[model samples]
Target: MSTLDQDLASQIERLRAEGCEIIRSEKVSGASRDGRGELEIVLQFLRSGDELVVARLDRLGRDTRDVLNIIHECESRGAFVTVLDPHVTTRGEMGHVILTVLGMVAQMERRFIKERQKDGIERAKASGRYLGGKRRIDRHVVRELLAQGQSVAAAARTLGCSRMQIYRIIGEAPPAV
Candidate 1:
């Protein structure tokens, strides 16, 4: 089995140990070119006919639209998702309402955080106090490793950044024109 398959199998095994009945599953690689190789595996697990079990809502989706779509899909299929850590369980009418409200709040929080970060960045730029983040790992070294047939995962581990960062750096090089 491939690494991805193994990882998913482990996740299913863990969920089953916790008494969840996983009906279906989809292994979603994270969005964006840079985020490739970052797995966001999703499973539709259930405890009973009316109760769906999820380790976390973020495991369901990252964005509000995606989360709502998943929730609606489960509801249409007569299933309600419950998160373990937050202790949020959605069973019926109240469940739907609570999920909707929580989705709205989470979206709002994301927007607010983005705005605040943008404001801080702008302020720091005006004051000339922000030098941006630490310099990224050398792209020349990255290219050397890739040319030597080293995998992105190995390169990322050596460079001390995520696989996503390695992809991003590789993507930014000037294309032959």
Candidate 2:
């Protein structure tokens, strides 16, 4: 298994040892709630006295507002949130204060990471070492195929890209087939 997968498994094992009955995990980015179905389910099914545990505050969310919103939602449903790394919980008012500070720190760290990434990209561009992402589909080839009267589906199949991508390259809507 990958390092992240192994780490998640280890965390789950540790939680189980600590008597945590239910666990929710997802491999998606914590940058936003989009595509995080597991988290949604946990929030939806949370009951009074229930606890939402995460390996770290950042694992819950990278954005300060998003993390606070999640914690608020849990609290609104009479559930508590627990972060295992630094060991914070919503069992007391102090926990709320600590979690808010941690959430802000996480959001600041995310911003710093983005800034570092942007600086690195700029340096690479200056050194002529950055070429951006490699083209997955050749627009010329896609255009030629479409000009040859190939259906959008046929072109997509030939190019190993989605029809949406083909349409995007051709700069036209999909013709009804």
Top TM-score prediction, candidate number: 2
Model 1 TM-score, all chains together: 0.52
Per-residue alpha-carbon lDDT of model 2 for 24-88, expressed as tens digits? 78899899999999999999999998999888898999998999999999999999999998999
Residue 48 shift from truth in candidate 2, angstroms: 0.8
Q: How well does candidate 1 score on lDDT at residue 22?
A: 41
Residue range 31-138, candidate 1, lDDT tens digits: 221232222223233223556565555555546676777666666666677766455767656766766666666667767888999999999999999889886688
Residue 169 lDDT in model 1? 81
lDDT of each: 0.66, 0.91
Sequence-dependent TM-score of model 2: 0.83
Error of 1 at 86 (Å): 5.5
Of candidate 2, the 10-residue stretch with the lowest lDDT total is 168-177
Q: How badly does each model clash, as a count of residue pairs?
A: 0, 0
